[model samples]
Target: MKRTVITVDGNGMLSIPSNLQDLWMSEGELVDMLHVTAMKLHAVIRSIYKDGLLTVSEVQQKQETSNGIWQTLY
Candidate 1:
């Protein structure tokens, strides 16, 4: 697992890191659908926040799991 920080711009936009973009691009034809990928990623992040799954213990448990993206935002 790896960790990195993301920043939201003054206009409230979050830029997906190039490393992540490259990884996703290698996953298949998603290179042509980067916008959709970003949207889905944002939605997943929003859902995690909305669902109150950001607790320390929960985040740790998720990081232990074998699949999916588990992120905690301050």
Candidate 2:
């Protein structure tokens, strides 16, 4: 997993680095390109919570069923 230190300002705003922003933009573009809907993503999150644990394989399976594009990100 990639980790980065993020600091929140006194106003409660997070200061995201440019690289992170670029990464997020690319992810967004990919999601759009793949036609992944918000509801599909939410369903994946709900399934994870219903399982009461975070498992990488389970998440990948759920994502595969929901969007079929998450594996590419990994």
Best by TM-score: 2
Error of 1 at 39 (Å): 0.3
lDDT of 2 by residue, 1-74 (tens): 33233445666676666565322223333345446885675576568877887754433321232455553231
- lDDT by residue for model 1 over 1-74, one digit each (tens)? 45343445667676667574222222112323343574575576568868897743443322332466553322
Error of 1 at 33 (Å): 14
**Candidate 1 collision pairs:** none
Cα error, residue 13 of model 2, in Å, equals 33
| Separate clash counts for every candidate | 0, 0
How does model 1 fare in lDDT? Answer: 0.45
Model 2 TM-score relative to the real fold: 0.29
